[model samples]
Target: MTARVGVVTFPGSLDDRDAARAVRIAGAEPVALWHDDADLKGVDAVVLPGGFSYGDYLRCGAIARFAPIMTELVPAAASGNLPVLGICNGFQILCESHLLPGALTRNRSLHFINRDQVLRIEAAGTAWTNRYTPGQEILVVLKSGEGNYVADPATLDELEATGRIVARYAGAAPNGSQRDIAGVANEHGNVVGLMPHPEHAVEALTGPSTDGLGFFTSLLAHLAEGSPLAGAPTG
Candidate 1:
């Protein structure tokens, strides 16, 4: 059976379709999920695409964290029963929901940055990054105003010690993120929050490179291995 990955659509999400397309391109079935709906539709994994959710009011993803859909997504992902990949605003939501650590603050430059960024994969064992080799650099789109990731020094040390740091900006930190971090994963590697937009870099025709497709393909491989998420409802 083909792996089914759900791409969530929030009120102001702008990359849901692109994310779904990337899933399909990665040899998996793409399912649409809504922010107002709590059901996951039995998907083996979920993708929270980029964009300004709820107009990014209050905070980038503060409002979206309380969305009806997140009620289900949070627990499932937190318990390691589901695999979730959050990008850009979705990353903010993951942090806001407490599924991931750290908060996305304003850029050091205090400007909305939009460009192709290079990231060095620090942990390739995560559900979304398994296809990448450790230390491999991949180029993906980075576009956001509040993309600087910050966490308490103790938490940062723990994340680094446990190999939960998934990726870091190569060379210079575009947003001035501490330690040049770009992404991180939960303890079990089932939940990941990335500031860069991988979904936007999955195709050559429309993206900087096809390197981002690996994130989607990695989830398919994880499901094929009969992970716990493989038992999820497939309806």
Candidate 2:
């Protein structure tokens, strides 16, 4: 059977359908998972697409973190049994859920920036990034107001030391994210949070380039390999 990837839809989500399309383009079945639904439907992987969930109340993704679906997603992802990819607002949700370290704060400009951004793949070993080559640059869409990622100094150092920093801004970071960090992965590498919208870049007709397809394809490759954990750096 082909791999099944779940794309979650929380209230106010805007890119869930785009993510599902990207999954289908990557040769996987896209399963629609609602925020209030507690069951995951046994999907091999999951994608949290971008949008202002719960109207970005309190903070981006703060309310969505408490959604019933997360009740099942958090533990499964924590145990390294489920692979989760959070994009843009989805990235904020992951941080709010504590599935990944650091918080995405307002951009230093305090303005919503939307543009095609270049990102350098910093950790190609991660489950969502394994199809990429380390240091390779890919262009994807980035549209957000609160996209600055911040963490305690120690946590930042730990993430860097352990090869968990998944991607970095290729040029000067538009949001002023610390250390130009754009994405990161959990210890086991089954979970990743990216501030860019890869789903929006999977098709040439719509996106800047087809670079974003690798993120979804990587997960399919991992599922096929049947690895309990992925993303270990290779020499």
Superposed model 2: Cα runs more than 4 Å off: 230-235
Report the Cα lDDT for residue 166, model 2: 93
- Those runs of model 1 whose alpha carbons end farther than 4 Å from true positions after fitting are 227-235
The alpha-carbon lDDT assigned to residue 159 of candidate 2 equals 88
Candidate 2, 81-187: lDDT as tens digits: 99999999999999999999999999999999999999999998878988999999999999999999999999999888988999999988899999899999998
Which residue pairs collide in model 2, if any? 125-231
lDDT tens digits by residue: candidate 1, 150-228: 9999999988888889999999898999999999888878899999988888878999999899999889888888655
For each candidate in turn, the TM-score is 0.95, 0.98
Please give the range of 10 consecutive residues that has the lowest summed lDDT in model 1.
226-235
TM-score, structure 1 vs. true: 0.95
What value does the lDDT take at residue 128 in candidate 2? 90
lDDT of 1 at 103: 96
